[model samples]
Target: MRHDHHGRTHRLELDDQTLREWDCTVVASDPEDGLVLDRSAFYPGGGGQPPDQGVLIWGGVQTRIVGVRPRDDLWLVPDPDDPLPPAGTVVRGAVDDDRRSLLMRTHSGLHVLCGVMARDFGVPVTGGNMEPGVARLDFDLAEVPAGFKDDLTAALNTEVTADRAIQVRVLPRAEAYALGPIVKTATDLLPPDLEDIRLVDVVGLDLQADGGTHVASTKQIGRIEVAKVENKGRGFRRIRLRIAD
Candidate 1:
């Protein structure tokens, strides 16, 4: 396994977005909790994207993994009552590929929406959330003009058809900050001791500090339809979106 600057093992999935399964050794496990693998392909949910669902195979038994969360280390929470494999046990982990693919599409679609908004409206995202086929992004805006939804939807689809390549990179925290990556949360929310940052770049479109899975290209996002736009409060508005299959 590889190690990061923090002395922790480098997440294998982070290095290869397309990886859906991996062989790993169990670092720890519990009957009530779940297994902690030395290396895991499951993303321990964060940054608005939910955790991955999968299964672990060990000792001629298959255990369904229903949830994952981060403690001091990433923990794979299997379905309730699932037996736990002992530490050092070699296991195979597999992510639900279809579900993960949908998440990647939805996540990338949201970024495309962000790019369109920033380019056309000069607004930054304040917050957001995502699921398999849908997502919503909150933006700092006092008001939107009539027909804003239709216009925004058209622009988003245009970018999808443009098929810009999506790129991911790791950079020094200072350099990333200097590049002005779009952040939905407060800057201070980022750890001060963070020496390196992962940046997602929608080439020629958008660049942001993000740690979620995404497709390789904008065309993979397909058509994005605006479902609703609600005014959350003064200077805050939310846009909902769905991807056409």
Candidate 2:
């Protein structure tokens, strides 16, 4: 049981995805209990992306960060057997760069898939999720197009070859809503109190309100393989993908 804090933890990763290490002040924590920081690079597992895993070093003691959850603020769950630091302690936090890079590539790759589907087939994404090197996206479609698998694979690779630049920005909710069809989800799905929305744009390909981290360019995704395509149900199709080394 943790109490809500009036302060919000600054999310450093949102602005700079390439940042792997940072020094932060401990805002709240309890010895042998939970932890919170003034700012964090951890992604707290939202919008289909998995939470970040890493380590925190303080006073020459390094503790493995097991899990993180988002409440009124981000909670840094460290190993229970290890003692937690108290407030005001300065610690150096480092994200698992290899894992985070893979996730960024995978996430941006999914957006590329969405772009291809919408541009060529006029389908919208229904749902999606991503891990370190793999991802799956659900699309609203009555039937798979002819040579769908091959065509999609080719299109995705084409985008990667094009090396499109990915852009991220924040816009007013109303302005974002005005984009209309570019937004993949219904307006009501956005939180009512959220006056501002974060948007991830795959250049001329796709635009959507999203909070997950992504790579700076589509080229970073490398070669993509359409691992599988399945019929979930009527009007629902699932596409599984992975990054080829």
lDDT string, candidate 1, 99-158, tens digits: 889999999999898888888878877888999999999989877998999999889989
Write down the lDDT that model 1 would get: 0.83
Clashes of each: 0, 0
Task: Encode model 2's per-residue lDDT on 110-207: one tens digit a residue.
Answer: 99998898888787788888888899999888888788899899999999999999999887878987876546742336767877788899998999
TM-score of each: 0.93, 0.93
Top candidate (lDDT): 2
Candidate 1 TM-score, true structure as reference:
0.93
Where's the lowest-lDDT run of ten residues in candidate 1?
1-10
Candidate 1 displacement at residue 220 in angstroms: 0.8
Q: After superposition, how far is residue 197 of candidate 2 from its true place, in Å?
A: 0.8
For all predictions, the C-alpha RMSD in Å is 2.1, 3.2
